[model samples]
Target: MAIAKTSPSIKYSFPPFVPDGARLIILGTLPGEESLRLQQYYAHPRNHFWPLIAALAGKRMPSSFAGRVALLQGNRWALWDVLEGAERIGSSDAAIRNPTPNAFGKFFSKYPDITSVAFNGQKAHDLFRRYVIKPGIVANDRLTAIDLPSSSPLHTIPFEEKLAVWHDRLAPYLPPKPQNRRAK
Candidate 1:
């Protein structure tokens, strides 16, 4: 008898961390094994997501899951993946198969405030365009989508370079810094 070699199917665990005031959403292909095990998006230590986001917010990288969520929500950013579930070999997005995309129609309707979406990688952008955009779901003028480099550590580009691109692209969507008024 021959043994079958194939990746296992996994369902997304954490619901989209979409704060009420979220103006921008960061979308990934799917949570990797480390993220799934830790029950947090971008849980892999080597992943550049936390560092890049922290730099954008002018804060240190958070060491805890709650802190990370605070960073996202505080900045009016949301996090979610393109797929609801998929069969993947390891954490590689290239190995994904039988992908079931999340309900973007319902999600967009529920979160009407989400004006912009940034894809964390090419695969995410491809999946979203093929599954959601091609179907005429995200045709509204209020929403804009941008494709960004993957932060999975698999991409060897310098962190500073990636940060610069993210900062420049995302700056307009992020909330303005609060002005501190001094007592007259």
Candidate 2:
């Protein structure tokens, strides 16, 4: 019998997608399988994240990746993951281990305009509360932090229900809906 060799998979997070004049940072757990492969956040077509954002901000979900990012940045929003890297078998947040949190203290210092942290899911919130907050890298009093419902399709909630909760918590942070301009 021959033994096979296998190495542990260590996935790393991408650089934060923070644009200038950003006021709110939305953090998620590690990218899922499809997202990692696609090299974009919420790449899964089934994910509600982009649609929710579009509906909330009164904008259309753009077709291109750059457009999607610009939409958020234009709205004074930022996006990133809670961990710098982690050892996980797959996309399951529960299976995550050896989590290395991002350098939040440095991030906060560099981006003073960021006044709030909106967690994209419960997993991100728990991880930040444990690794980032417990280590004293960031003080809860320093920023308004809210745990929004997970935008994952696996969450099994109606889109409207999730949108309602998201709107309630994040409307203040999001830019106002665009006004329809009519032809003169």
Candidate 3:
């Protein structure tokens, strides 16, 4: 009798939070286990994603799923992962294999206004460039890619540093900050 070996299966990512009139798209590699289990992006309490985003946008961290979505949509920024599916272990990008990139063709067709893509980390940027940009599928003369520090607790870089870069890099595409209107 021979023993059988099984290969690891690829896990698929959730639907993107792309909205119409979006100018910037923030791309991550893939959601971690906690995020997948919670059916939310960056659901881990230790993850700095929400805090960084809120600080950059000059808004409070969203405490609810709907609030998070609203924050991104309101800023005309989109959120998605570069890889739609991959065989990864323990939520580490280094463990990822057999990656399948997201459908950028359809996504770009729907959100033609998107001017730039900001990658959350090197893995996301590399994957997108190798799978989509280099292939000429999503890359174009008008569209640019920016690499930002990962907000994952795994990344170890300070949140303030990441937030500064994110704010500066994305400022041009972001809408003007809202002002508090007061009436007598």
Candidate 4:
């Protein structure tokens, strides 16, 4: 009798956080173990994603999940994953298999104002280029892909360096500094 090999379970990505008037959509490969457990994107404590967003927007980092979501949405930013689901025993993108991309065609149609698709890392960018560029899926005339440094602690680039890279490439799409409102 031969012993059978078992494959990893299929992990599903979280629903997108596309808000009204969203102009930019940030895509990660998929949420990691911690994120999945927390049911939030980039939930890992060491992840630099929230800090980067706060720094870029010139705002204090929001601590609560709802507050964080509001911060990004208020800035006209959306968040999602490149792969809707993938089979992987671990959180490593390299180990991902049987990947299925999100519904870009319908998403693009519904959210026609989105001008930029920002990938959180090289893997996410590559996957988008490979799977999300189907006919009528992306409005090429309006959509531009922006490569962003990964906020994962596993990524080698330093936090400050990553900030610089994102500031350089994504300055236009990132949320601008909030205006101060004086009491009337």
- What C-alpha lDDT does candidate 3 achieve relative to the native structure? 0.86
Better of 3 and 4 by TM-score: 3
What's the C-alpha lDDT at position 184 in model 2? 100
Q: Give the alpha carbon lDDT tens digit for every residue of 5-116 in model 3.
A: 6566677798988777888999999888899899999898999888877776678987998887887887888999998999977788898999999999888888888879
User: Residue 131 in candidate 1 has what lDDT?
Assistant: 84
Per-structure clash totals for the candidates: 0, 0, 0, 0
Each candidate: what lDDT? 0.86, 0.89, 0.86, 0.87
Task: Candidate 3: give the clashing pairs.
Answer: none
Q: Which candidate number would show the highest lDDT if scored against the true structure?
A: 2
Candidate 1 residues 103-136, lDDT tens each? 8889889998887999998899999888888888
What TM-score does each of the candidates earn?
A: 0.91, 0.90, 0.89, 0.88
- Tens digit of per-residue lDDT, candidate 2, span 34-70: 8889999989999999998888767798999888888
lDDT of 4 by residue, 102-134 (tens): 998888888888878999999998888788775
Count: clashes, candidate 4: 0
The candidate that achieves the highest TM-score relative to the unseen native structure: 1
Residue 23 accuracy (lDDT) in model 1: 77
The parts of candidate 1 lying over 4 Å away from their true place are 1-4, 140-142, 179-184
